[model samples]
Structures are given as structure tokens and as C-alpha cells.
Target chain A: MADPIHQFEIHNIVSLGSIGGHDIAFTNSALYMAIVVVGIAALLVGASSSRALVPGRMQSIAELSYEFVADTIQSTAGKEGMKFFPFVFTIFMFVLFANVIGIIPYTFTVTSHIIITAALALLVFLTVIVYGIYKNGLRFFGLFVPHGIPIYILPLIVFIEVLSFLSRPISHSVRLFANMLAGHITLKVFASFITLLGGFGIAGMAGATLPLALVVALFALELLVAFLQAYVFAILTCIYLNDAIHPGH
Target chain B: MATQAHTEHPGGKPQFPPFNKETFASQLIWLAVFFIALYVIIARLAIPRIGGIVEARRDRVEGDLAEANNLKEQSSAAMAAYEKSLADARGRAQALANETREKLNAEADKARRSLEAELNAKLAQAEQTIAGTKTAAMANVRSIAVDTASAIVERLTGAAPAASAVEGAVADALKR
Candidate 1:
């Protein structure tokens, strides 16, 4: 059976040489990221080109995605958070397109990498912290202090809250990274089982149908996960942004 | 898998590809580049266009609704005017009919009263004539009687009675 991990390996498309003692060559990962970005740009630009009062299919999709993210941000972060709309929209589309495109065979899963997800999560984290502090000053620390806690337990509660607040990025990034990594690895394993079983001849080929069916079911499930993880990432970003805008218990 | 990666790369690190530090900077650079590009595209191009479309549609619909409401109000006003005229015409017809009826009734009553007065006047004249005729006839009868009485008296005496005496005898006989 082929190594499932092999598919995740990055290959250089162009050798850009060392930058600050780090390898900065353009790789398949970068190529796929470029594809996702260009694809999104093209779709959006083309969809809006006609500007029909009554939307066509492509336009409908564009509008629906825009409204979906808009509503999510509006609900989670309130109107004040509309300032972060472009940031949030970019993150949502990036994650969504990366995840969905990764599902296609042989395409690099950009969000599957810990570095990528961590980068995205850290960006949101830093933005929240910077904006919260900038907008709210020291009051942003109120995020760690409950409004109606007993004085006796306020210290412990604040400690826990601080710890939880600090851990947001870890959980946020890991949730998406782990889900995609595991799902892809599992799909690859099950697909390998079909090949493994088929090598054993007629009975084995007949038995391979089970893993094949499992792969199909898992494939459908992974598609849902891809969409769900993107949504989860976007909503969580909104929630964190909400804390920045209105920090309280 | 770590050993396999180790063998595959021979002296390189055996870390999982996802956790590998080697490509982190490259990925970050590309991520920043593409994400900013996407943000620019969406913010500068897409959002404004979509928002404009929605705004335009809303304005159009609201304008159409307002126009419809205006037309409805005008129609209702016209209907009210039409109804008022219709009611006015109906009242005019009623008043006209009442006035004509009253005039006809008054004229008929005047005609009847005049006819009654004329018939009464003619009846009074006829009664007066009957009274006069009765008096004249009575006078004639009285005279005829006197003549007959006088004739009879003469035949019995073999001589004509005197005129004055005959009249007096006739009057006495009539009285008796």
C-alpha cells in the first residue's frame, strides 16, 4: 500500500534559495494556495461582472457566500465588528477554499498543515488582542474577570478565565488541523485497504467492497467536515472578535 | 512513518510534514500575500457591487410600492367623488319628483275646488229659477180658478157678475 503521509510531502516547484537561513522555495503547497486564491478571485470577479438585478447561478453563489459570512459576523460580533469584515471574510474564504480544494485528489491541503492553521489562528488572536487593547485600553482585561463572581473565588475564576483565553488560538487552530489531517489519513488508509485486499485475488476483491464502501461514506463525511470546519473557524473568529469588541464575563 | 521519512530524506529532520519548521516561513509569506490580495479584491470590488445591487433593488421595490399606494389613493378619491355625484343626482331626482308631485297635487286640488264652486253656483241659480217658476204657476192657477167661478155664477143668474165682485167672490171661494 502507498504511504498516506507521502501525499502530504511538499515538493519544490521553483528553488528560490535560502532566506534568513530558511528554505523559501516555492512548493506545491504554495502553488495550491495560489490556485485557491486565484480561483476565488476569478469566481467573485466573474460573478459580479454582469451585476444582474436578478442573479444567475454564479452570482447567487457569490451573494449567498457574502451574506452568509456577513450574517455570521453580524450575529456573532455585532455591528461594531463590521470593521473587521474584510479580515473575517478573507479568512473564511481562504479556509473554505483551502479545505474544499484539498478534498480533490492530489491537491495539497493547505489547512492540513499545523504551520498554516497556526498562522491563521495567530493572526486572529493578534488582531483581537491589538484591536481590543487599542479600542478598549486596559478594560480589555475584563475578558478574564466575571461580572458577578463572588469576591472569595474571583482570583481563581480570573486565573481560569485567563488560561482559557490564552488557550483559544491553540484550540482554534488544532481543531481544524487535526480534523483535516485525521480525515485525510483515514480516507487514505481505507482506500489503501481496497488495494491491499484486491491483491489477494477474487475473494479478497469481493471483500474489498467493504472498505470501498467505507471510503465512499468517509469521503462524503470529509466533504461535510471540510465545510463544517471552515464554518467553525469563521464563527470562532467572530466570537473571539466579539470578545475584543465587548469584553465582559 | 518518522523512520520512513528519515530514510527518505537521509540526513534531514524526521518531523511530520505538517510540523516541519523548514517550510513555515515560506507558507507564512504566501499566506500573507494571498490573504491580503483576497481581502483587497473582496473589499474593493465585490462587497460594494453586491451591496449596491441589494440597495438598488430595495429602493426600486419601495418606489414601486409608493407609486402603487399613490395610485390606490387617487382611485379611492375618484370613487368617492363619483359616489358623491351619484348621491347628489339621486337626491336631486327625489326632490324633483317630490316637487312635481306636490305641484300636480296642488293643481288638481285647485281644479277640483274651482269645479266644486262652479257647480255650487249653478245649483243655487237653478233653485232660484225653480222658486220663481213655482210662484208664477201658482198665480196663473189662481186667475184661472177665478174665471171659472165667475162663468158658473153668470150661468145660474142669467146675467154677468161685476168684475170687482167676481174677483172678490173667487178670492173668497179659494180661501174657503
Candidate 2:
């Protein structure tokens, strides 16, 4: 059997040649990311070119996605926070497309890696912290101080809040990466079972079909999860952006 | 618990690659590159275009609504003017009709007065002619009676009686 970890390996698609000590290679994941970017551009352009008063199916879908993100931003951060809508929208689309593309029969799930999700979460975390500090200065630390707490319980509450606040990136990144990794691993394991059992007698092969069916069902469920995770990530980013804009309640 | 742990430790397990500095650095390097690329794309391209599209759409809708409202106001003004003109036309028609009725009444009154004057002149002329006719007939009757009395006297007495006497007798009989 092929090593399961081999599925996570990056394959270089375009050798941009080495720069300094690094290979500077553009991998399959990079190529696909480029594809996703171009695909989204083409889709939006194609959908909007008609600019019909009554939208077609594609345009309706595109507009619906736009309004969905816009409304989410407005509801979470209010109008003052709407300036971040485009960023949040793009993030939602990119992550959603990346996840959906990964679910193809033989594609790499980029989000399955801790490094990718951690980088995204870290960026959000750093952005909020830096912006908060830049905007509010030392008072940014006031975020840790809960208002109206009893003086005796203040210390304990502040400690808990600080710990929870520090765990944002860990929890955010793990939520996406773990879900993808578990789903991909389960799918791989079930696919392996079909082959392993098929090597036996006809009755065993027949039993293997059950796991195969389950794999198909799980694939559909994973597609839903892919969209859901992207939504969750984008909404959380909006929340974080809100915090940066308005640090206090 | 210590004795059981010792037995598990003695059992062989295959060694795997250790998590170390190099692995962490390489992961961080790749992550930094990915994040930089994403941020660049977002900041440079995707966000600007999305913002432009949203703003453009909003402006267009607002402009369209403003234009529609302006047109509606103009249309309402035109409708008001049309109604006023129609009312004006009806008022002129009524005024003209009233003037025409007054003119006809004046013409009718003039014709009636002329016809009444002509009828009064004709009645006076007829009365004068009747009075003249009655006087001429009385004179003729007196002369005829004198002539007839002369003829009767000539036949009865063989000589005509005096004309003056006959005339006086006839005049006396007419008076009586």
C-alpha cells in the first residue's frame, strides 16, 4: 500500500528554477490556486457581463454570494466595519473554492495542513493585534479587562480571558485543519478498505461495497463541510476585524 | 504502576523522524510565502475590484431612482397642465354658447318689434279706406233716388216734376 502521508506531498508543476538556496518551485497546489483565482475572475466577469435587470442563474448565484458576505459583515461589524467586506468576501471565496477543488478524486487538500490554516489564522490574529494597538495604543490591553466585574473575581476572570484570547489562532486553525485532515484520512482509509477486501473472495468483495458506499456518502458530506468551514472562517475574520475596529464591547 | 511501565519500555518500537528546528523552519517558511501571496492578491486585486463593483452598482441604482423620480414629477406637471387646458376649453365653449344665445335673443326681439310696427300701419290704412267708401256710397244713393222720382212723376202727370223738389224729398227720406 502507498504511504498515506504521500498524499500530502507537494509536486512541483513549474520549475521557476532555483533562487539562492531555495528551489523557488511552483507546485501543483500553486498551479491549482492560480487556476482557482482565474476561474473566479472568469466566473464573475462572465456572470456580470450581461448585467441583466433580472439576473440569470449564474449572476443570481454570484450576486447571492456577494450579498451573503456583505450582510454578514454588516450584521457582525455594522456599517463602520463594512470597509472590510471585500477582504472577507475574497477570503471566503478563495478558501471555499480551494476546499471544493481539493475534494476531487485525486487532488491535494491544501487546508489539511496545519501550516496553511495556522498561517491564515496567525495573519488574522496579528492584524487584529497590530491594528488594535496602533489605533488604541496601550489601551488595547483594556480588551483583556472585563467591565463591571467584582473586584475580588477580576484577577481570575482576566486570567481566563487572557488564556482564551491567546488560544484564538490555535483553535481557529485547528478547527479547519483538523476537520479537513480527519475527513481526508477517513476517505483514504475507506478507499483502502475497498481494495483490501476486494483481494479476498467474492463474498468479501460484496461486503467491501458497503464501505465504498459510505465513502461516497462521506464525500458529499465533506463538500458541505468544505463550504461551512469557509463560512465559519470568514465570519470569524469579520468578528476579529470588528474587534480591531472597536476593541471594547 | 512503575513495574508495568518498565515492561512497556523494554518492548521495541520503530523510531520515526523527530520534530525539530529544521522542520519548524521549513514549515514557517512555506507558510510565510503562502500568506504573503494571499495578502498580495487580496490587497492588490480581488478587494479593489469587488469594492468597485459594489459601489458602481449602488450608484447606478440610486441614479436610476433619482432619474425616475424626476421624470415622474415632470409627468405629473404635464398632466396638470393638460387638465387645466381641458378645463379652459370647456369654459370657453360655455362662454361662447352663452354669447351666441344672447345674440339670437336680441335678433329675435328686433324682428318682433319691426313686424309689430308694420302690422299697426296696415290696420290704420284699412280703417281710412273703409270710411271713404261709406261716404261715396251715401252720395250715390241720394242721386239715384232723385233720378227715379223724376221718372215716376213724368209717367203719372205727363210732365217731369221739378228736380229740386225731388232731390229735397229724397234727402228728407234719407234723413228720416
Candidate 3:
């Protein structure tokens, strides 16, 4: 059997020569990202085409998707956090679409890559920094300093808080990337086992049914995980943004 | 069975492009491009239209409620005004009836008083006429008595008597 990690390979589909000492080749990841973005656009645009007072199926899906993100933001970040609604909503749709599409038999999962998730997480991190500084000025540093701590442990707590705060993007990106990576790998492994076992005989084919069942169950689990990861990503973003808006506690 | 990919490829190659520094810049570029585009589309198009729908529905409902309340107030005011006018009309009718009754009563009283005065005047005149009649009759009775006394004395004594002495005898007998 081939390596399971090979499926995650990002190869150059359109090889563009190096620009500014950098390879500007278009990749499978890029294609899938475009697909996700286009898919999202098609959903929203198609759903809103009728603009019906009573929503049709497409419109209901679009509106429900919108309200889902909006409600998540409101619950996690409160009303003031709505200024970042577009940012948070885009992240959610992008990740969710990517995760769902990735579950298809041969489609690329863009969110499975650390670079993509990291870039997204970094965007949020930067937004928090810029917004927190702009909103609270020098008082934004209060995030590192927890209130009601004794003076003796204040410095230690501040250090730990600052470390954890700086590590947000790493953990956030890794969580999504790892879940996708692991789920895809396990599915590939079980699938290879079933195929390898099926080649032996009627007895081998019968034995293959166990792994086949597991693969089916795993696919279902991966689908659930896909949605869960996206939700977690969005809610975390809201929570981080809430910190940006109110950095005191 | 699925199409077997990478069957001849070496295992444990560690060719994960995500960690590869070569593709980071390009991926970042496209990601930024797609994200910003989506953000613009969502913020500019979808959310606002949906918000407008919700807001319009809310406004319509509120306007309907307000119109209902206004109609209720207007109807109640009309009902109150109708009741007030009905009461006013009833009072006026009652006043007119009372006025008519008082006027009739006054007229009846005047008529009764005038009728009583006329009757009293007629009664007084009748009483005066009765007294005059009684006085005349008494005078006739006195003269008749005097003539009767003179005739009786002449016939009994077979001689004629003096009229003045007979009259005095008759008046003395009447007085007794």
C-alpha cells in the first residue's frame, strides 16, 4: 500500500517561474480554495436571488448559514464584536466549506494544511493586536496581567498568560490541521487494509468487511469532525475577538 | 476499490507542502485574496439584504400594530363622542319635554284660575239677584197683607176702614 500522507501532497498544477526570488506556482490547494470560495458565493448569491419574504430551500440554507455564524459570534463575543462579523463569518464559511469538500473521495482539503490555517489564525491574531491597541491604546497590555492576583505571583502569571496568548495561533491552526490530517490518514489506512485483505480470497473478502464497516463509520465521524472543527475555529475566533474588545478580564 | 494513488511512490517522504517554506507566500497570497473578496461580498451584499428583509418585516409589523392602535383609539373616541351626543340629545329632549310640561301646567293653571274667577263672578251675581228677588217678594207680601186686612175688616163690620190705620194694624200684626 502507498503512504497515507501522500494524499496531502500539494503539487504545482500550473508552474509559474519564480517571481521576486519566490516560486509562484498555482497549486491544488489554491484550486480547492477557489472552489470553496466560489461554492460559498454561489450558495449566497443563488439563495438571495429570489429575495423572497418566505424563503425557499436555497434561501433557507443561505440564511440559516448566515444566522448560524451571526449567532455564534453574538453568543461568544457579545454585540460589540459584530464589527468583525464579516471576518469571523468568512473564516467559518471558508473552513466549513473546505472541511466538507475535503471529505469527498478525491477532493483536496485546504483547511488540512497548517499554512492555510496558520495564515487564518494569524489574520485573527493581527486583528486582535491592531484592534486592541487601537481601542485600548497602552491598556491593551492588561490582557497579560490578570486581575485579583497577589503581587508575588503576578509576574509568573503574566509570563504564563503572555506565553499562552502568543501560542493561540499555533494551537488554533494545529487543532484543525491535525484533526483533518489524522482523520484522512486513518480512513486511508483502513481503506488500504480492506483492499489488501480483499485480494486474498473469499475468506479474505469476508474479513475485509470489518475494516470496511470501520471505514464507513470513520467517514461519518470525519463528516461530524469536519463541522465540529469549523465551529470550534469560529467560536475560538469570537472568543479571541472578545478579548480584543474587552481585554481586562 | 478506489484508484490506488502513489502505489509505486516511496513511503515516509515527508513532502507535506504546508510545512514547505517554498509555497507559503503563494498560499498566503491566494488565501488573502479569497478571504478579502468573500468578506467584501458578504458585507456588501448578503448580510445587508437579509438585514433589510428582517428590518422591513419588523417595520411592517410595528406599523400595522401602530395603525391598529390608532384605529382602536379613533373608534373608541368616536364611540365616546356618540355616547356623549346621545346623552346630550336625551337631556335636550328631556328638557324640551319638561318645558312643554311646565308650559302646559302653567297654561292649565291659568285656565283653571280664570275659570274659577268666572264661576265666582257668576255665583256672586246670582247671589245678588237672589237677594234682590227675595227683597221684592217680601215687599209684595207686606202690601198684600195690608190689603187683605182692610178687605176683611170692611166685610166683617159692614163699614169701610181708613187705609192708613189699616196699614198700621197690618204692619203691627206682621211685626208680632
Check candidate 1 and list the clashing pairs: none
Top-lDDT candidate index = 1
Q: Global lDDT for candidate 3? A: 0.87
Clashes of each: 0, 0, 0
Candidate 3, residue A90: how far the Cα is off, in Å: 1.3
The best candidate in terms of TM-score = 1
**Top DockQ prediction, candidate number:** 1
Overall lDDT per candidate, in order of appearance: 0.88, 0.74, 0.87
lDDT measured at residue B123 in model 1 versus the true structure, 0 to 100: 100
User: On DockQ, who's better, 1 or 3?
Assistant: 1
List model 1 lDDT by residue over A75-111, tens digit each: 9999998898888888888899999999988888999
The parts of candidate 2 lying over 4 Å away from their true place are A1-6, A9-67, A82-90, B1-23, B124-176
The true-versus-predicted C-alpha distance at residue B102 of model 3, in Å, is 2.0
- TM-score order, best first, reads 1, 3, 2
Query: What's the CA error at residue A169 for candidate 3, in Å?
Result: 1.5
Which candidate, 2 or 3, would have the higher lDDT against the true structure? 3
lDDT (10s digit) by residue, model 2, range A1-249: 434444555655656655455555566556666666666655555675666655688766766777788899999988977777656766787778778887887887767767667878887899789988988898888888878989999899989978988899999889988787777767887888888888889988999999899999999999999999999999999888888888785
Candidate 2, after superposition: displacement of residue B110 in Å? 1.7
